[model samples]
Target: MELTAALRGQTIQNRVREVGINPNHWYPVAWAHQLPPGRVIPVVVWQQSIAVYRDTAGQVHAIEDACPHKGVELHLGEVHGDRLVCPYHGWEFDRSGQCVHIPYFPPDQKLPCATALSYPAQERYGIIWVFPGDPQLADSRPILEVPEYDDHNCLMIPITGVFNAHFSICNENTMDVFHGFLHKDLQGWFDPVLLNLQDSNSSVQANYRVSYKGTLSKFLGLSTNSDGVTTRNVSVHYQYPHYHSTMEGVSSLYLMRLPVGPNQTRSFSLLFLPKVRLPKWLLRAIKPVLVPLVLRFIFMPFLEQDVGMMESEQRTYQKDAKRRYVEVNPAIIALQRLILRQYEQFMQQSSQSNPANPASQPPFESWQDQSSNSSIEPLTVPHSGKGQ
Candidate 1:
């Protein structure tokens, strides 16, 4: 559905900051290349601890991080052939997370049924994606497509990020183009104006027209030179847990989000700069070096500043959850609405479908209200081996 692109002060929804992920989509867990064959990589998606391992044939599988026997972390185990061997005992679990072997078991005794939770996992765009939702819906949904992946003119740079903020806050930071002021010293874009905005139950898309005039903008091919003023249209599209933004035709960014918990988030991003691509052979030869360098020098600075501000916002929010905040960006308001709506939908479905499942909605009454109290339990982040 279409939404008005006009910028106006809209009422803010504080609940968006208090909700959780729907867990019904393909979320990035780790970089595929980082998880080598015959190795285990533990990650989390919305608090679901998963141990991702690649088999001998280079196939990825995601299983419950905890062993069913003694609750040992499966990532501490080893990968042999297509099965993951539990370290505590010689139990072997297959790709389906089924315990198929016990080294000490008698030949006449049937293997005791043991199965760990498994998720539908796959690889694309040099990243590992896991479907944390219903396994039945795995094949029906697809990862966000990046057409530039096959284009030779684009130099694809895969970047990873860890943010000390809620996924909603991180997402809002992405939808907000007006924050360019924060990057002024770095020669970031300026004079931002929201060009268009649209939203739905599952997504929000926005476009902004901004002026660029600085070395950093020129380096990104956004302007002709650092001294000259160049106006460009930047479009940001958020298809729920993932993002695809483009700066005219110069470059594109695909940010896949890993919402580990309420306050911690990680991102697997691919930055494609069509302007940076050179001769095919030379580009291919130096890409290994060039990609990391550009990501470090050109991108990390902006991200560091953004992360600082995001963490600051989260800290403030934690202190006063009931604090009324003012926002001028209509796009941000729309994005917040979408975030809150998704959580509400998930809550609604979970209530109606899983009446008997007690562990559906988070335990709200027993815990102190974060909005009312300053302190709460630290967020749980399994994949990154960090606690929020």
Candidate 2:
């Protein structure tokens, strides 16, 4: 269904702030390079803690962070060959989360029916993605496509963002191009006007005509001269679990959000600039140094500013959920409505099915949890243990 693009002064539902994610898609969990071979890194998708490990062969795997036996955190364990070995009792679990070994058990003894929940895991575009929803749907959902990733003429800046706000807040920040005023001192953009807006069941696209001037503008390849202002179209597309926004191709950002819990969210993003295209071999050689420089000197400042504002919104929302709010941007209101509706849909499905052990779907509260899991016990291993 297509939604109309009309800005109005309308109040929105506060429940949007509490909405959950549709877990039926694969979400990027960790930086590909960060999880080295033979090492395990713990991550959380929704509230479920997962132990992501790479075997000696550099293959990535994600299993429920908690061990099936004794409820110890599987992340505290180590990766042996292709299996994860529980630190508590040396119980070994394969990539499928099946316990394949128990050192104390005699040979030929059937391993206890102990298996940690495993997610559908894959590696792409230098990141690890896991399906946090129905295992059956993993194969059908598609990951965001980026053709620029391999193109040499593009300068890619990989960025990591940690937000103390809900995913909805973070998402709103991305959709609202009018917030460029927040970066005025840095010469972000000015005179923003929504030129077009369209939405569908899977996406909300907002295009704005905005003027840019100053050093930041020049650095972003927005204008040939800093003293002159250039008007361009900034289109932001909220594609369900991830985002892809482009400023007339001068810069492109792909924001993959990971909803950690109610109060926090994380983003793994890749910013591609077509202006800096170089040869493939040469670009590969310089990417290590260039990627960080652009991220630190160029992108981080904007992200930091956005984070401050996002956190502020979250803090205030926490203080008063009933506070009346005013909204003018039709795109923003539509965005909020779509968010709330998705969650409501998920909740409706969950309520109608009432399946035994149903896992959460979205709207954050609809589906019941079907997986057998446990809570994380802080200090499960000795506090003085290695790497503590």
Candidate 3:
């Protein structure tokens, strides 16, 4: 549904900070290159530990991180052909997580019914993705698309972010363009006005007009006149587990979030800038130097500032979960509602599939009713004299 473009103060709910992710979607676990053939690494999605490894044949697989025999971490084990060998007892498991060999087993004896839960794993866009929910649904749910990944006209920069905050907090930081005030010293955009806002069961789309200035503005193709002030529209799309934001054809950012636990989140982002377009040969020559330089001198500073604020928010929220805060951005509210709804939907499905599982109950029943009212007003930033 469409939402109004008016900013208004509303009581913020603490329940958003406590919600868990709907594991039915695909999540990026690690860069494909980071996990070499015959290597194993441990990854967590929504608190579920997984051991991901690439077989010698170059196929990726994900299984429960713990060995079913002795509860040892599988990541510490070795990769033998297509199976992962547990270090503790030399128990070997195949890609399907079925125990195929035990060092001490007799030839005539049948193997025990031991198995580790296996997840659907795949490699795409230079990232390893895993589906932590029903394996049948993995084929239907699609990964986030990045059209600029293979485009020659766009310069792609891979950015990784580790934030010591809840995924909700980190996600809100992306939707809250009003926080540009925090980056004013870096000549970030100002005089923001929400132009459009839309919300659905699975996504939230927000568009805002913002003014830019300074050398950074010029480098990003955000300004044209010598007066150094240029206004552009910024659109942010939150498609549940991931985000895509663009600035009037100047730049595009696709942020893939990994929720490690309730207190930590990691992001795998690919930033594309049209201004940095260059011949493929020249781009390859300077990419090593250029990617780091832009990331360090340009993006990292803004990221550091955002990290500090997000972590601080997490700390305060932890200290007093009941503490109330006023929020003026309607986009933020829509994001929270989507998060809650996804979790509830997952819990409801889990209950329907297995009614006897007590764990399938929604974490907090109070929050279920919270998703009823989904209307939200748009965010509006106060105008500065220079921009107006």
Alpha-carbon TM-score of each model against the true structure: 0.90, 0.88, 0.94
Candidate 1 regions with alpha-carbon error over 4 angstroms: 223-227, 358-388
Alpha carbon RMSD to native, model 3: 2.6
Q: Mark the 10 consecutive residues where model 3 has the least summed lDDT.
A: 366-375
Q: Model 2 shows how many backbone clashes?
A: 7
lDDT of 1 by residue, 1-388 (tens): 7766655445566777778887788999888779989999889888889999999999999999999999999999999899999999979999999999999989778987899999999888778899988788889878999888888667888888999888999999999988777877777777777877887877888988877675666667654634487788899999887899988967799999999988899998888888762677888888889888888888899999999999999999999999987666767877877777666666667667777773354633211212212223322212211100
lDDT of each: 0.81, 0.80, 0.88
Report how far off residue 136 is in candidate 2 (Å): 0.6
What number of clashing residue pairs does each candidate have, in the order they appear? 1, 7, 0
> Best to worst by lDDT, what's the order?
3, 1, 2
> By TM-score, who's the top model here?
3
lDDT score, residue 358, model 1? 36
Query: Where does model 2 exceed 4 Å of error?
Result: 224-227, 277-286, 351-354, 360-388
Which number leads on lDDT? 3
lDDT of 2 by residue, 189-274 (tens): 76777878888877888888877776676666665444477888888998887999998859898999999998999999998888
